[model samples]
Target: MMNWNMTMKRNKLTVLIPPTPDNVNASEWWPVKSDVNWIETVYSDNKPAPSKLQGVDVFIGTDFTYEMAKFADKLKAILIPAAGYERIIADALPNGAVVANASHHEAPIAEWVMMVAVALDHKLLQSHKTFVTGLWDHWPGRYGPYRELFNRTFGIIGFGAIGRRVAKLAKAYDMEVIASGRSNNHSQIAQSLGVKYCWGKQGMKEVLSRSDFLLVATPLIPSTLNLIDEQALASMKKTSYLINPARGNIVNEYALYQALKEKKIAGAAIDTWYKYPTEETDQPRPSTHPFWELDNIIMTPHHSGGTDGTRNRRAQTVAENIDRLTSGQPLINVIDF
Candidate 1:
């Protein structure tokens, strides 16, 4: 039997690639060396054992655990092919191993944010249903008043890559952009993006009170978990809209349902959810609350960042990072542990 703890040199590097979409030939974007050994695996919680993961030098997957990490003695780098790495524990990795995250998701997710914001603002679902059923001409009062995207205040809770992208798009629509973040000082970056930046509790209230459309783009962290609770929801203008393309738990699920049920806020565009399907065949309810029954909100199956452009861009980023790693160049998008 091979000694799992014994570190091995990469005469022929082993690259582990996860299953890609049917149409996407991953080789086109993530090209590898001729001598490299490739390992293919199904992405799931029931992963292969440490013995099976022995010689992995580069792992390109979304999920990793401490149990699996312990066996990766020869691992040089772990590359997350997706934007979010909240679940990844930095301390779990082997000594000297580096981790990097990819983000071509920003552009597509930003577009989704803007699309749903406009759709909800105009009450598109209600209007379309009313129009299709021929209720518009008969009952104009049934459909609520619509709003425009122009000259409105667009607020973002987290000012990361996705938030900045959303800000840029919002600015293109001539909307006033305001952002609040966990960072003590994002003033310069915010100002450069032509957005007013705020921080901490008091600043959050200021942004919430004035925003016409509020977006939650923060990552899931200890401090950010349930960041948008009842108090936060109450602080917002009753006429404002909420758009969440970030993690589901970032907002208090129950409070959001209560707020929407009572019409406290105008409406919301939610692309992320509290619950998700575990398998390809399994269909799970997104929430305990029947958000689907609500007319004021728009719900999507957490697919905001899923686009062909996004996939290709992400693949390119991963490929470039791999090249950078081989050339001993400082890698881009290195996660600050």
Candidate 2:
């Protein structure tokens, strides 16, 4: 292990940033005047050569495969510019190294959640498509009426950062918010936000059955993987809509496709998916299922939290952690496990 006293005296830390969408504008947001030596590099096939990691004091990228960890002899910290750190291989990290992640995505993701909720309830996409084709069937006078978010129940599967933000936003529209988490510990926070909180299987069922609009905001983990299955989907109201901006696999892909296809529920707005492009030029489909053919669903390329504000805030956090490391200070947002 490097001596903190000696490292602080030297006051020169090396930060390696790989070419990632999260780090594309890193230079613009990084501390312009600092002792830190920022080394910008590229990787092929998403794997940097082991030599590139040598002498790197900090790594500011998402993916830390076993291959990269084998050579991160000098790495003191792995700072994930984004909130999700599943790509990081914790078992392979060098001993004494700390892992941390930044999160400024709640605001933007909440905005997207509400936007799509309103769109789904009001059938905005359907109306727009019809009107552009010179069809008046969707006209208020002819199509009867559209739904509003007011007084409707908004259900949340996870009561974390994103869930709390969404609950606050949902209140703005005069919606009743109810949430279920892994435990009852978040009940106090939920109460402060004027949200009804529950936990366990019974709690989840209540949220699912009563919700007019459901939002999935949980992290993907062993317990949460495929948390929403066919049986869970069947519990929802027939008129309810589902919105997911978190990890994709949290909700079973096949079950979601089947529900939408059979009109089991009203509709869905999915921002995350099962498959993604492996290369820059690749245009692989987001899922094995034909979600594009479904008109009731709104599909996005997992960009709900990719706003400029999110990027800048995350970059600032990374820069702060690097500064903390060089100064022998404790890092922020450090993951315990």
Flag regions of model 2 displaced more than 4 Å: 1-9, 19-27, 44-47
TM-score of each: 0.89, 0.93
lDDT of 2 by residue, 190-269 (tens): 99999999999899999999999999999877788899999999999999999999999999999999999999999999
lDDT of each: 0.82, 0.88
Query: Which parts of model 1 are misplaced by more than 4 Å?
Result: 1-11, 20-26, 33-35, 45-51, 137-145
Shift of residue 232 alpha carbon in model 2, Å: 1.1
- Residue 104 alpha-carbon offset, candidate 1, angstroms: 1.5
Worst window of 10 by summed lDDT in candidate 2? 25-34
Model 1 C-alpha RMSD vs. true structure (Å) is: 4.5
**Considering only N, C-alpha and C atoms within 3 Å, which residue pairs clash in candidate 2?**
none
